[model samples]
Target: MTTSSTQQQTSDAFGYKWARRDSYESPAVRDASRAWLLSRYCGGDAAVLDAWLAGGPKTILDAGCGAGFSALLLFGERLRDHDYVGVDISSAVEVAAQRFAEAEIPARFMRADIATVDLPPASVDLLFSEGVLHHTDNPATTLRHLAGLLRDGGRALFYVYAKKSVVREFTDDHIRQQLMPLSDAEAWAALEPLTKLGIALGALEGTIDVPEDIPLLGIPKGSYPLQRFFYWHVCKAFYRADFSVDEMNHINFDWFRPANCHRQTPEEVRAWCTAAGLEVETLRVEEAGMTVVARRVSAGATYV
Candidate 1:
């Protein structure tokens, strides 16, 4: 949608900016939150992370790390040897650092815009980014920079929003355009209609079944993750959608984000990878987004 603000900051798809907020995250919200945390380095998609992490003994850079969720999940209890550096433009950097301290993990966080974050060339073994690049000033340029940070034979795991889901599309558009820019109080007021609708629809109790007509692409069937999906759309999308200390501060930062890119097609991503000189290893579609693992190699270079 069209946003009119003195300053527009980069935002995740649908402007669902992730940060610390006091609003107690609902159960479904918490599950979604945990899922996102699990999606960082080894992300929720283990296949992509595992493949990229094949040949190891290297450190990882959690590019666009929002809350250190992914970093902790990836190198948490099982694999704690690999060092991790988490970076985000938001002040969550401090929160993330604290989380690492509590977890006793060799992790650190910095508040730096990934696009302009000046990292040494070819210094990292793996670059893990999820739902971050698209929200940057220039997504393609961001990807190029992230790729540059990878050492030779190093792999990158990226999870970008894919333009294949209808429900998700509706949810984001409704929030960004019809009801964004409202103060949390005002936004919460505006959300009454949605919450009511969800309750009514859910109250249907399978009375009026949704006809098997237009397929809701990407979104799985059978009440799969329905509670979380509803909360995200009805409440979280409108109010502060995070659960952490000093949340309003984080919410305000998210409110000012300008650049908000979104889902792309496989053809689009594949073309970009080829043009960037990265070899695509795996490409898959998920309910909410897509996963791509590509390796940046020199001309005439190959890998096993």
Candidate 2:
């Protein structure tokens, strides 16, 4: 298939998947619930977010902002003060709108591909695209496009999956190919075994000592926490005990359903930042792969 055609297919698939965000994320039903308030700050350190927002009222763009979950985390109750724009390529934008409205957050959601989305040049103060670019047909090019949206000296953060062990990589590819032909319901049904396996492995609370290095796959021989190793090598990284069965299924579907999920090496991610003239503030290889925070070198310079 052509590149544009592939991009459209990926977007449509995400559109379908994210419309069921409540199934996965369980967005708050009412304004008073603890889930409602806590969901706003889920999965991130508040102090780090505060540091990012310290500059005050800047134009923030959440590229691939799925269901406004990140927006809730980023803006919280102070939404009226920040200029936040969320662009996505799915019906999830509508879901995001509803969720934000429920929270009384004055955030806007637009349905558009982040790669081709048009905005004023050098207009964004902070651009956040997590777990989004790697699903695009061309991650490097899409990343450059995202970088172009930032004002020179503006900050941006991204998360992409890290390259995995060769065994795991092939297993993921095989499972994804099998799942691709199945309907969402069928695919979820098919993934139950894997999820159960993950649950079983998580129960084995012990450490794994990798006595020999697998140089071919770049897996260093070391003492790895068993839970982390199980997640890193088996079960599609679905070891979170707190997630409900449906939520775990959602994670499984997210991994196997996407048509274009790319994993990159640390060197490649660093190279992209360098090519875009973004000075790296931090680059961490966490469970999600690589999380990078970078700033454009100049205050208003174009990235072309």
Candidate 3:
């Protein structure tokens, strides 16, 4: 896996942002709560959850293990005796080490790019990556490399941003370009209006009835509960009663800071899996993106 100068720069930027993460554990969150959140993070895809709960994996790779939250939830206080490896291309690996150590989950954290990260081929049983690949310079290439790490029967779950309307595509790129050049502080300042827009929309209670799509705004025609719609459409960084202000800010920062963010269509993702010799097991597409659970297949098995 070769890294380009551009990819290195983007990795460096993410490293800085995640290094100063607000809180490793949310307020009053326990082992159970963390697990619950992880489940929700998977978009409540039952097949994926069921496979995870079946619990036969001996080695797990948290590929983009941001701050080790997913690793902690997966192995710390529940699954035991598994070799859990968390790798990231940032100082967030240090934060993950601290958090996992506190949780008594014996795990390894490495500051390495997922595309180039080293582990024996076909040595992993489960690979869990969420919200990571799309941030890379070439998501298809990265996904293929990661897939090679899994054993023939091994499985991986990937969460990637989905392609939205043309209007949304232009707006997102425009905002990111403006913010990418600014310092972290300055970028956060620039995102204040967008953040507030999200909050203001989230504050509206009750459901909205829509009869047709608003193409110009990239809003689809649907009956959206006010809060849910605000979250999915207006902005994803809205303040929540369950999250800290810093957490909200982190979400906003995550969106605008990254220099390489590529949204993919389902057809493209399917093509990737097929080329990588993977068979899709579970797939759930939400407003933000799609959550896919695929297993490596080397034989005559079909992939869809």
Candidate 4:
């Protein structure tokens, strides 16, 4: 598919996903997500995040904000303290606007591609793009464009998927390709079996000890839970006992329905940051992805 078509498909998939907000908006899920976000961005200290938000950043940009969930999870009432702008490539921005309106929060929402959105350069003080860059046509180029909108010394916090085992990577691509032609509803229905499989695998309480590292497949030597071993080395069957079946399916659909879900290595991510004139402050790498906190160092810098 062409880049534009791929992005459009991705946008449509996410729009459908976000519209079913109630599927994943339970209190338990919100708390868990908030804790994870804090751990990654604020060193597990809510005070750190609070202080940063109160640190005189007058304007905040939520790039690729899907239904404003991340912003709501991160900022809460503190969002009212700044001029918040949410830009998304899909219709989810409408949901975001309605949500903020109902919450009595003042904000602006725009439906536009973050990579080429018309926003004044150096007008933003804080930019947040959670799990978004990887879904773009070119993550590095997109980052460069978003970073250019930040003033010198402004901060950006974003996340991207990390490269997984060779088998898992291939399986992910294969699944996504198969779902590309299906409507969003059909794709969601198709993922139910995978979610059930994840539950079944998760129920088998056992661990496997790999005798040694299998570098060829990226399987490290260690004891892994049965479900996790397959999840990390084979295909993604996201399982969390706390989440409902639909919630689990929501995650699976999120992973498999998008056409532009790119995964990258830590080295590549760091290079993208450097090329975007961003100075990395903290970069946390996990089996799933990388979370980054960076500050803009040069407003006019371009990707090399």
Ranking by lDDT: 4, 2, 3, 1
> What tens digits encode model 2's per-residue C-alpha lDDT throughout 1-304?
2247556656766776777766565533222223432332333455656666676788889999877775575457756778889998777788888888887878877888887788887899888886888988788888788888888778888878888887678888899888877776677788888887777777787799989998886577889878677666653747566666666767777787777889999999999888877888888775458878888887466542
Give me the candidate number with maximum lDDT: 4
Better model by lDDT: candidate 1 vs candidate 2? 2
The estimated TM-scores of all candidates read: 0.69, 0.85, 0.84, 0.95
* Candidate 1 residue-pair clash tally: 10
Each prediction's whole-model lDDT (CA): 0.59, 0.75, 0.73, 0.90
- Regions more than 4 Å wrong, model 1: 1-56, 164-171, 184-196, 199-204, 207-259
Candidate 2: where are CA atoms >4 Å away?
Answer: 1-3, 26-45, 205-207, 224-227, 235-237, 299-304
- Candidate that would win on TM-score: 4
Of 1 and 3, the candidate ranking higher by TM-score? 3
lDDT by residue (196-262, candidate 1, tens digit) is 4544444343322223444545433434233444533233332332333233323323322233656
Clashing residue pairs in candidate 3 are: none
Residue-level error in angstroms, candidate 2, position 220: 2.5
